[model samples]
Target: MKLLMMAACAGLTLNTAAAQEMSYGHAEYLNSCAVCHGVDGTGDGPLRDLLIRRPADLTQLSERNGGTFPYSRVFATIDGRYAVPSHGNREMPVWGRLFLEDDAKNYGPSGGEVVTTERIHNLAGYIETLQH
Candidate 1:
């Protein structure tokens, strides 16, 4: 029936959209955060031993913050608006300007800041899923 076909098509559309969103976040995580945060979002990245201090176990963020994910803090930290002490000088890079430059290259300067915001927001949303 048309109704059944429509429902199935709608479900596929939603699923495809979800898959794309998850792909963006997962790709971003693997590209940027995994170098320091590890593939599983723990603090056990390959470069962990090279740093001055061990990175925070990302899975514990919600537990440490009393069972709620610190979404804003995570966003700010990703975008360089907030400082996380454990990141240290050698461990963390200020991604805001770098992300802006990236956006400027891809979409021009007019929307660089907005693009950076979206990237950071997506990255934060991805991190939230890592909660224990």
Candidate 2:
């Protein structure tokens, strides 16, 4: 029936959107966070032994935060707007600014902020999906 076909199409569209969104975040993570957090978000990255402080296991974030995903907190951390001691005296690059820089380079500066926000949110959403 038309109704069944419509529902199936809608589901496919949603799934495709979700897959694209997650793919963006996953790619960003691999490029940036995975060096310290590991590709699996296990805090056992190859560079872990070189860092002064151990990276937190991203998979345990929900467990540490009382069973709810700390969406805002993760966003802030990735955005690097506020100082976080855990990020080590701000030595690490702020991912938000980095994304903005890329956007500005590719699309000019008109809507860099929007792209930056999307990048951070997508990354945070992907991290949320990684929660155990």
Candidate 3:
């Protein structure tokens, strides 16, 4: 009946939304992070050796972080919040602010915290899938 049709349509809509969100994250990684991190998240890109502290081997993150990847901490570090002191300075750009600016430019008005949160979540999700 009409109720069933409506539910089906709603589900389809949600699925489409989710797909779009995932695509954005994938695109973002491909466009920005992949240059340094490598497409396979191995940190073996051409610029890897140029970095003073060396890019992280993301696939081994869990082993490096006590058998559990501290995702929140990783997200914070990627977003340039929790600085690695031994890295010798903030070498990575603050992605949170960069994403906010990009969102503002794309949406006319800034999406503010929501967009930042989504970007972080999406990036984190992408990173989680990199674990070996």
Candidate 1 pairs with clashing backbones: none
Model 1, 1-132: lDDT tens digits are 999999999999999888786766777888888887899899888888888888778899999999999998888777885565677554566787788998989888878888988888878888888898
Model 2 whole-model lDDT (C-alpha atoms): 0.86
Query: lDDT of each structure?
Result: 0.83, 0.86, 0.77
Model 1 stretches with alpha carbons more than 4 Å out: 1-21, 82-90
**Which candidate leads the pack in lDDT?**
2
| TM-score for each candidate, following the candidate numbering | 0.75, 0.75, 0.70
11-129 per-residue lDDT for model 2 (tens digits): 99999888786678898888889998999999998998988888889998999999999999899989986665765685456887788888888777878778888888888988998
> What is the RMSD of candidate 2?
7.2
Better of 1 and 2 by lDDT: 2
Compared to the true structure, candidate 2 yields what TM-score?
Answer: 0.75
Sort the candidates on lDDT, descending order: 2, 1, 3
Candidate 1: C-alpha lDDT: 0.83
Off by over 4 Å in 2: 1-22, 84-88
